[model samples]
Target: MIGGCAPIDAGGSGGGGSDGGARGDGGGSTGVNPLDNPKGTERGLGVIKSAKDLAEAIKIIEKVPTKGRGPKTGYDRDEFGYAWADNAEEIPLAHNGCDTRNDILARDGEKLKYRSGSNCVLVSMTLDDPYTSKTIEWTKQDASEVQIDHVMPLSYDWQMGASRWSRSKRVQIANDPLNLMPVDGSANSSKGDSGPATWLPPAKGIRCSYVVRFAQVALKYDLPVTAPDKDAMLTQCR
Candidate 1:
């Protein structure tokens, strides 16, 4: 849950390479090439349209093993950690005073506005949403308009083998920037823990990027995906 309702600090350039803009097909200004931001420390999920890069994305997807999605029994959002907790250890931007949600907001959004006297609390910003290829000007009043998505949704993580991981490990994956993106709220809600096999971004240009991020998350945690998910991921690039 968000706290601290205060005046915004006005616009400023945010970290995370958002200033690079959407350097991909179609004309818009948001996102960066996923290949360039391999560690996931940067901002925005850029489109991958090059034939050579698409092939590379395919190879990355192929490296992940396949498995049937396990039952969602006893799964809860709290299993990983509290909502946007900043205490998650070993993940980028964690323990950085700002919560995960705000950290990503500053990372991905441009012309960032922070809460009064605090650089860590985001009050407003503009975004070029990769999932829908649209621009959004957002503020605290309608916070839900932008939601941070787990590239590999948490429940999907449990089904993929995170259930067996220790609490700290789970927290790490949960808060890791590499596994997260701020995107259109409705699109994120529609995803609902579904894998690539069942869902992809509405923006065709970003589909390959979405799956590449999924594969990266999977490979990072040594997690496997459902066979169909892997196949669908491969199909995105080709």
Candidate 2:
């Protein structure tokens, strides 16, 4: 469950049947491709079907160095910044008078409803959850059905190389749109700090795109994943 999921028309786009806008066909949606959405500000994870794109994806993954995971000696959620802060430096959508959570909700969701007189707090929406390839018709009362997931999870960041990063830099990565997605809460929960070696979208066709997105975040922060994770990430592009 997440914040602001409730069934209210409020002139918002209505959910499209049981499918909402999601295809729910087991493969990934025909949403934006990872190569086209390097900033991770795009809508959904589409299947990467082109050899050219896959080749580019490989190059991106290859740029990230591999290292053994370090001890999470002092990893705290707060270390990244208070959850969903809009004050993080050098990140998009920060200080926009709305929190990071709401900014993402607006970015990915369709058929959206906003709270009365509030442009930021979404009251309801239809989400094409890329992780599970499911169409989620969510209301404010049923918020947990969807969540904003960190592609390069904060905890994973700690174990990878972020334990040594400065506080402001840590905050930037935490709230960066390049590392975020809105997806099925259950799928997100399953990922819990694991990387490509152990976790990926349930939508098999999205794997290459997912791993590519993961690599984007890693390289952006100059962070390294475990060797196995890097190998797994490279494999997904094939």
Candidate 3:
């Protein structure tokens, strides 16, 4: 989570792209498109299908313990030292048969201008930042401002359970679409390595939906959460 809270330009909301728009799949139709209707949000998976479903999920999520599931404090001089990407360059863009960053850039950016279909270097685009409910005007949308933020920050994963993961498995988790989203630069930076207990989206109205997705992602990845943190998520999601 962001180590300190920062006030943001909280006013204004604008619609940028259609949620129903079609996305490229690398192959003809083999890849899954988010618009095809999100499945696997079953009750057993902590998704809210109804009021009762929400209540039930909240109860289960709240009962989850807290201390053993979070990252180690004083991990270094900084609270977020482990949060920054590690071995990013050595990870090799070609390992996945393509670059993971470009794949996400194209997946998350609109009106993307690509180069030779070999890499995801966008010339222009509009970005819908999920965390702040704001549209970032990306003249070049390049790599800096438009970041593929892990919904659950990686450092949090490393300490909780990922420290033991194999390198390839870690890479897969790093690039998994379910855990990634395009977000505003400042918002993503502010979130750092915090979890649901300490941080959340700036758009207050959508907190329930946001927390629901957080729980789903954590559950899917078999990541653990602290008790207070889990309670906070359930309360927010409810």
Candidate 4:
């Protein structure tokens, strides 16, 4: 069974009530536990509601080394690996006979329907998108309605010194679940390559969790955020 929230009817209206929205709890066992799910195996981007939790999140954010962004020369998505490559090594859900994209969809999506004769191909599912606080009924036909956001954008990584890393390291950062989120398509587009300073989740409640996830990815990869980005991240928790 899927972890977090129950599957909502696809044909139903847009809003699924606050509880239905993706936050602290959604799918069953995966119910939005960002602090605990450091490896990104959990389903939703769980909320950090308590003051103590918020302070702890801020502590993580403060430790992220800060640096100025570098030029975008010699940076390309292919440097990471084939997009959503199933073969990317040294990360969760790799070599599972499924690409990173579909793996995450199955991990977080509810009432999943796979393509005929293929458990790996997700044709449709419901997403309580954390970025916009919306429940999206997504189908393969309307693929852009939902997008997998890189918590740390690849370009930002490049600017922050990923350009100097070996190609294999880039691939791990790209496919790492701690760095990815299936969020509303438009929100993802608007967030292109921006750090926390420039863009944040529209859902006010998830900002702390979002920044914490950002910090987690940065720390894991040994990448640093811009000074302003780090400051903005701390603000979210405060």
Pick by TM-score: which candidate is best? 1
Q: What is the per-residue lDDT of model 2 for residues 1-238, given as tens digits with 9 covering 90 to 100?
A: 1333333222234322112233334632535776777666655566676678788889989999988989988899999988998789877677777788878777777777888977678889877777787878888788887888999999999998888888999999989988888899899888898989998888877788789889889888998888999899988887
- The candidate maximizing lDDT is 1
Q: What are the models' TM-scores?
A: 0.90, 0.88, 0.64, 0.88
State the C-alpha lDDT per candidate.
Answer: 0.82, 0.78, 0.51, 0.80
Clash number by candidate, in order: 0, 9, 5, 9
Deviation (Å) of 209 in candidate 1: 0.6
Model 4: how far is 20 from its true place, Å?
11
- Per-residue accuracy of model 3 over 129-217 as CA lDDT, tens digit each: 55565657675534577666777777777778777666655665565555666667787888897887788867554455456656655
Tell me how candidate 3 scores on lDDT. Answer: 0.51
Ordering by lDDT: 1, 4, 2, 3
Worst 10 residues of 1 by lDDT: 6-15
**lDDT for model 4:** 0.80
User: Which segments of candidate 1 are over 4 A away from where they belong?
Assistant: 1-25
lDDT, residue 144, candidate 4? 94
